[model samples]
Target: MRRFMKLSRKTLGLLIIVMMLLLSGGPGWARTLTVSQPNQQIYQEANFASTPLGAVPQGAKVNLIRQEGEWYKVDYQGTIGWLHRQAVPEAAPAKMDLSKMLFGGPVKETGSDEVALAGKGFTPEVEAGFRQKNPGLAYAQVDKVETFGVDQAQLQKFVSEGGLNP
Candidate 1:
């Protein structure tokens, strides 16, 4: 009876340890997600208006800790942070290709195609066409503007900092 009691207690203790380990995600499988947005903001709290921890660029991998509605708790760069579900995907999303999808290859000098897509009246092609129409037009300065770009992030800092002002 004494031997059986000791063995039973030992088995019970081992079982409890195993259960605790499994329950705490030690042996459990972790669901990892990849940030799909060009910039994904990590929030200090689950709320969007909360302080931002930092930003994670597209294709960055994050361990899914837990989910609360539209917000997700993720472990990114050894830091626990909250990210909106829209900013991440189960798998990395394919980046958008404007030249291929919008322009359909080398666009014409008059970039009417970009204007149609961007709703902006100006593109390098449009400027070039303007220069052609009027050779005296000094558009070289304006052409340099198109080279600059900014990343739009779905994060608290982005929201507070005026969110991707083009």
Candidate 2:
């Protein structure tokens, strides 16, 4: 009878330890992301707390370290970069149709700059970077980003018009 009680106590202790481990390990598995935007840049030794410093180009992948609302914390090479959640693409279902999704949502287009901007899904980070680097223009002109809606040929044409390398 005493031996039975001792074995029961050991089992219970083991179970408790396992439960504690499981409870403490909840946050171990975190979501990671890779860059899907074209010509995006990752800082050499900085972090992406809310937004990435420069654009992370298309097909450039990274692991997501953390997330806060629309922003993501990511690690690439030895550098940490913040990327917008919308910019991150899932592993499966590879392609995206930007034109149909962007301007068609709720907001009606009056053919204004805001409408054009809305259709492109352009972020302030991208605009600011281009503005700082590419001066001598009234504004940064994005042509091919709008072609994200169509097939590859249209996209290629758009990129060419905008003089985008990719």
Candidate 3:
């Protein structure tokens, strides 16, 4: 207490600044980010077709080593991998403020509902009505087909081996 009181104002201010910098993860310090998705897939490379190196459950902390466009290179559970930007929240999204932005914030947010509906824009009411009208639509088969995906990494590997590169 005596030493702190004896310090000049300028010195105290400089000490405070240095402490702040240290706490703020200054240069060469690996910043950390949290996985926000229910499950986030980390790829070996940054692409839709890259091999999935592993997955991180929601709310997992990861050391963010670097970022490239829509992907972040992270250190997760003792492994280095690349995670999609959307799979993590850089920070919680800013709250919507009505009377300050166009259309007064959002009237409706699709959110995870969009994924479950497969982009068909189906509200629960709409889905229920559709089901009532089309009792034999085979929605299960449609959902299965919608989930199919072609691996792009495989195609890249194929091209490299077949001399298809220009």
Candidate 4:
């Protein structure tokens, strides 16, 4: 009886450890989404199970928080809603393209520079300055600029230029 009790306690402790391991450690299956269509309206609310919560033009980006069957739970404008999986790109945390999230619109030249040139027009000096600032930037003009993690000032400038707000 004493041996059996000791064995049972050991088994219980092992089981608990295994359960904790399974719950705490694993592949993070979170999905990050980028709006794949041009002029796609992301509604402020989820009108339907598949209706885009808001319009994310061509390159709007978001992070997937949950999955409801064929739809995705995404963070949009400080709110959550469902978007069709088809509208979002492949789910992977590694390839999250935040160019739009970083700069506002797509990673196009006009889009990226627009924020810096807002209320004004793009000029040679402006372009030169941007080039000087981001020497290694992929393009001379960018519709999007990904700051990788986050920068409030950069985000604010991007938002001021009508970039997607996080």
- Best lDDT goes to which candidate? 3
Q: Which rank order by TM-score, best down to worst?
A: 1, 3, 4, 2
Off by over 4 Å in 1: 3-7, 89-166
lDDT of 3 by residue, 98-145 (tens): 323335554454465422333244555789899899999998898899
Better of 2 and 4 by TM-score: 4
The 0-to-1 C-alpha lDDT of every candidate, in the order given, reads: 0.69, 0.57, 0.70, 0.59
Return the clash pairs for model 1, or none: none
TM-score, predicted candidate 3 vs. hidden true structure: 0.40
Worst 10 residues of 1 by lDDT: 89-98
Candidate 2: what lDDT? 0.57
Better of 2 and 4 by lDDT: 4
Query: Which of 3 and 4 is the better model by TM-score?
Result: 3
Task: List the RMSD of every prediction in angstroms.
Answer: 18.0, 16.8, 11.5, 18.8
Stretches > 4 Å off in candidate 2: 1-32, 39-55, 89-166
Worst 10 residues of 3 by lDDT: 92-101
Candidate 2, 120-151: lDDT as tens digits: 44566778887889787665245556544677
Error of 4 at 20 (Å): 4.1
* TM-scores for candidates 1 onward, in order: 0.45, 0.34, 0.40, 0.38
> By the TM-score metric, which is better: model 1 or model 2?
1
Report residue 46 deviation for candidate 2 (angstroms).
12
Q: Which parts of model 3 have CA positions greater than 4 angstroms off?
A: 1-29, 90-166
